[model samples]
Target: MGLIDSHAHLTFPELHGQLEAILERSDEAGVNQIITIGVNLSDARTAIDLAERYPQTIRAAVGFHPHEADSVTPADLHAMAELWNDPTIVALGEMGLDYHYDFGDRSKQRSIFARQLAEAAGRPQPLVIHCREALDDVIPLLLEHGFEGRRVVFHCFTGSPQEAAKIAQHGWRISFTGIVTFPKSTELQAIAREYPSDQLMIETDAPYLSPVPVRNRRPNEPAHVHHIARFLADLRGLPYDDLVEETAKNTRDFFGL
Candidate 1:
């Protein structure tokens, strides 16, 4: 079975300028599908456009990332909500808390996240969360908004086992990126090793974290997701093909692909 880079930002400048080459490489690497995520309203529109252009291989997820929280407006949210009408818009986020950079006001990030959650309250689309050093607040906010038992995923998870367990307890998912392959990410590898297979998925989060052997390469692309799959297969003691099938299935199930 082919692998799926469940999370990526294909519309980002780093990758957008050379999408044809990227898709060619991804094909050669066995990454048959990619879900391009949007960090803001404009980016989300671009993501939808990319998905529309490459219907078979790309899908889009829309939301205001925590880093852009400070710049969001009520009208922006309304326009984003209108995007759901697009058949290509598969999910509603990359949204959540990020205390690490504090690029956006923490209060605004939380408020915007809450507002988006409220907007998504009963929608059928699953959530694609972008939590960084803010799981405590993230989990509570998700629950506060009645997300328990809902379809949600914490993308590029770098949390501790306890945090992973807490997310699992809520029937949510945790997706891994190339970061898990870093030598210093031993604890993260451990979390991946034991995380529920059904709730597990993989991504490149591309134009960003490139897996080892290619980690030195800047502006990582979906093609590098193959390296991540191989690394995780070894880390979890499973055959490479098996890990690919499992993660691909999980990604498809989660994103309704």
Candidate 2:
């Protein structure tokens, strides 16, 4: 089976303009499917458009990012809530806390997160969470709302093993980005090596954290997921093809693709 990029931002300008070539390279590299994430209303619509245009290979997730939470108006939330019913939208996020940047007020971020979590609960859809240095806050909010039944995933996970275990305890999955391949990511690699295989998945988070061997080479793309999968295979001491099939299956099962 080919690799599935569980998370990416193909609608972003870095990769959007040359989608044809990007997708071609992705397909050639054995990356079959990609979920393009939308951090706000505009990108959400754009993501849907991209999915529709590339129906064979792309799916979409829509929600306001925590960084953009402060500017989110009631109308924007309403619009996103309405989008929950759109058949093409597969998940509800790219949302959560971001205390690392403190881009938005912590309180505002929490409020926005809770609001979106309620919408996700209402629709009973999976969530693509983005937590950075705020798991302590994010975890409680998710639990307080009783997300036990939700299929939530921590995207671009770069957390301690304890944090990973915490997420897994809640029956949530964690997706690793190219960052896990960095030489300095020994701790992350150890986590990946020991994390339950069924709860593990890989992504490129393209147009962002490019994997090593091509670090800072240029804007990342879905095609680079191969590097991540290979790195994980070596880390976990599994056959390369086996890792590919396993992660692809995890991606499909999680997103219900």
Candidate 3:
């Protein structure tokens, strides 16, 4: 039952502390590949370095997350644009607006997101978006400039079934993280029901949002993505092996893995 964690923050401090052990456990859990998402300029170098050093174990996606909107500048965006040339960097994200945190100026978040999206336009690279209580603004941004060679996936999706359907209609995929396994996440489970099997994917969002069985831990890792796949497989009444294969293929095709 080979699998892939489409979104895992291996560069995060908590998980990065024990990356080798985590990788060993991920392999044991059958999670064959992991994508390390760079949420800000600070982590970009680490993400790229990891991907370059361990091409078979990791891939990268770099962008300015909404939380860091205030910290980023036009100069930061320019630097990120140059990173597009790195073969190990597959996506421009996890980037998008997030009203939930309100950690940065909302306007700043929107501006950064739009800039990043525009930079990603026409490129073959897929996007790893992180929309949070801001899909009303997020969806249209993605629609404004259509994706090209690769696809876009809403990582650790926390949207409603309606929002999921809306993105699905636009040819984007929605990924579930350990959060989907939360006992209280009935809505996430319901949203899961709305997407067609082929349009859904799973992730760990490691070092955060660890699924139910593993939620007690502060940080998560790729190995725990298996818990999400299992939970969804049972929730959807699909065979585990079939679900794993489909999601793995979905990850590869979306990221051009």
Taken over the whole model, the C-alpha lDDT of each candidate is 0.91, 0.90, 0.84
Clashing pairs in 1: none
Q: Write down the worst ten-residue block by lDDT for model 2.
A: 116-125
Model 2, which residues run further than 4 Å from truth?
none
The parts of candidate 1 lying over 4 Å away from their true place are none
Q: What are the root-mean-square deviations of the candidates from the true structure over C-alphas?
A: 0.8, 1.0, 1.6
The collision pairs in model 2 are none
For model 1, residues 55-172, the per-residue Cα lDDT tens digits are 9999999999999999999999899889877899888998999999999999999999999999998789999999989998998899999999999999999988999889889989
Which number leads on lDDT?
A: 1
lDDT of 3: 0.84
- TM-scores, in order shown? 0.98, 0.98, 0.95
Pairs that collide, model 3: 207-220
Cα deviation of 77, candidate 3, in Å: 0.8
Look at candidate 3 and tell me the lDDT of residue 41: 74
* Local accuracy of candidate 3 as per-residue lDDT tens digits, 1-257: 48998888899878656988998999999988999998877698899999998889899989888999998979999998888778899888889989998898999998999998888896778888888899888888887766522388888888778888787777787888887888888998888865677667888887888787878877777898888888888988999898899888877777888
List residue ranges in candidate 3 displaced over 4 A.
147-150
> Among these predicted structures, which one has the highest TM-score?
1
